[model samples]
Target: MKSSILTRPFYYLWTTQTTANAADVLYIMALTVLVLNRTDSLVSAALMPLMRSGAQMLSGLIAPLLMNRFKLPALLLLSQTGQCILFLCLALYLQLNDNNSSLVLVFTLVFIMSFLDGWTVPARNALVPRLVAHEQGLLKANGLISVSDQVVQFAGWGLSGLIVAFLGPGHTLLLTVILYGLAAVFTLGVKEPPDVESVRRHTAEDNSAAPSSKWHTLTEGWKMIWQMSRLRLLTFMDIIDMLGGSVWVGAFTLAFVQVALGKGEEWWGFINGAYFAGTVGGGLLVLTLARAIGNRYLAAMLIGMAGYGILTALYAINTRPIIALILVLLMGPFAELSIVNRRTLIQRSVAKETLPKVLSAQASLLNLVFCISLLVMASLAEWFGIVNLYLLAAGLTLLALGVGLIGRRTFHNAADPGAGD
Candidate 1:
């Protein structure tokens, strides 16, 4: 028999999140194209991610303060509603302007929509364990969510071009607004679990530790990640991943597909689609073998980190399209496995109440690293070439793996409740 936990609220959460994910990708694609068409400047196109990342960094830093006041469901609803309104306004502005496509207005809307999105990411992640209810099932639940998220991205990005060509950017944005509205409505159906005592205990501890202050509250998540051992390790891994992840960004990947692969733009699209497909397959593998993996969360992460690095290194040297595509496809499962296990590890280690705070802090740190890496990677790419940049990314991942191996004993002890104490 199926668990009741997965039947109603969990089901609703999945549906709502998947729908929002699709809208998120669609609008991002639409806006990127819009920026290209309007400005015809690489710098303006680059600014798109910078604006969104900046908003995400700010939102993540402050989300914990809001989390203290609002429940996850309510926060999610607000995010969806906020994005819906922003998209509607942008669409209206475009329609009335007869598609003049003001760069300032477009970038501003992107920032706002992404800022709202920042809250939903951590809130939804923290809500997953609560919905699943069983610690042992967390890996399974995470795998399912990861699979759905990748699948949604694949479908959304795949169809986005066709949608924009037929309906135009304004109409495509209206479609996004509708999707956001549906997400908000579905979020209303989410039934949060009862209050966790650990949450209350931690809140009390924080209150007693420091006088009530906005700055203290805002920094609480950062303090928690730093003070907690398991969290610290995971956050470090996350930073490395973010730095390496920049290579997969639109700017870098597009350059690679053009220069290294020496293939048409269609190959660029195909390679991306293949990676997502591999990720989906990986998630399914995790779902089936999670039990067999047992408590070896650290091992799973190490293997993933190592596998991804090795594959990336191989990809950097190979000039053949078939070889590069295979490497890209093979990297997907390892990447997904690493991502899912590390997240599950955090969910298992952190107290239920504090998960959002930890996740938000982690998100903030990722954006900070990603933003910096973008600048660094771009500079390095320009100076050393794209293949060398890929090699550098692999080296960073392997560095993370080396750190993990050196700290292997620490992983075994990191999760102890008294370790932080």
Candidate 2:
């Protein structure tokens, strides 16, 4: 099974993605350190992430135009290569200037790099189905990717500080450049199957049937999601989930530790570590049971969503720090189950040519929702207290689960031909 599923193309894709993800973590850390060192203000440091998110959101909004024109491997390569060049330039600029005045230039480079990176996720996801030899491999492939992502997240944050402390931010940025370059090289080795040509032909035919315009291209994915009942529900659930998930951002988690658990930063770190640990476990579990879960994706997704919601609600009400840690740890597997299945469903639900656009539209919407959700969650925490804010998040998750329950039949029927068109 492993031999069949882990084809050469898939191996290249996985390695490319994993290397790029690690580079992302290093880049963010190095940039944050640079910003803080130059500006000496927490607010200034925070702007790095804000700008990255804003740039990525804008990029996602316009990604369909490029996706329509370029092949997935080319897009992935372009994104990585562009980021590598920009990051190298940024590092060189900081090295040459050695002054705080270069901060503006630094931010501009970061935003541009992030804009390019916005193409990576959707392109990567769209390419996965093409790279894998069999439909059954999708689950295992996604699970493997998820596991790597979680490991990166877990180790990246924990070690980035130490890496930066040891190597300094400038050197860290240089290291990221190397990673990006390697990723670009790996991307060059990824070869999509011949069926992708047929997908492109079909897309070309559809394009010829209609009068194409920038507005049509931009809104094409949105229209598809709205018209397709299955996609519509899935996207709606995603929005709700993002809104709820925002409560787990660093600031809110810190506040929760201080207010509810009466713990310090260490506990906050512990909870996060536990959550990532759980996610890794969950990914392995899914990988082991890929065939069984793959057969009943919707059912598994619903169960996962239900478990996550119930655990979230319980965690919100709990005051014990240890229990809170355990609850979040438990939430990991459910989160992974739902996330992996939903992503797999999205990849399988749409036509091959259409998947990138659909994913781009969904990514844009989720990014916007997450940005707004951060502000909303912050305000709620200030007004009603952190506990209530979490309760509200739990409520949102449950509401999303309710939507899944209501759409169970629609999701199942989505397997039919043209059901999600």
Q: In lDDT terms, which candidate is top?
A: 2
Q: Rate the local accuracy (lDDT) of all candidates.
A: 0.83, 0.86
Question: What does candidate 1's lDDT look like per residue over 234-329, in tens digits?
Answer: 788778767878999877887888888888888888888888888888888888888987767778878988898999999888888888888888
Cα error, residue 182 of model 2, in Å, equals: 0.7
Q: How good is model 2 by TM-score?
A: 0.94
Q: After superposition, how far is residue 28 of candidate 2 from its true place, in Å?
A: 0.9
| Candidate 1: segments with Cα more than 4 A from true spot | 1-7, 197-213, 418-421
Q: Give a tens-digit lDDT track for model 2, residues 1-421.
A: 3558668988899999999999999988888887778778977876776687788899999999888766788889999999999988877777777664478778888889989998789888988888887888988999999999999999998898899999888889889999999999999998877789667656656665775576788899999999987889899999998998888877788889999999999999999899999999889888988977756777788888889989988988899999998999999999999999888888878877788899999988888888788777767787899999888888888899899888877865745433432
Question: Candidates' TM-scores?
Answer: 0.94, 0.94
Scored against the true structure, residue 386 in model 2 reaches a CA lDDT of: 92
Superposed Cα deviation of residue 275, candidate 1 (Å): 1.2
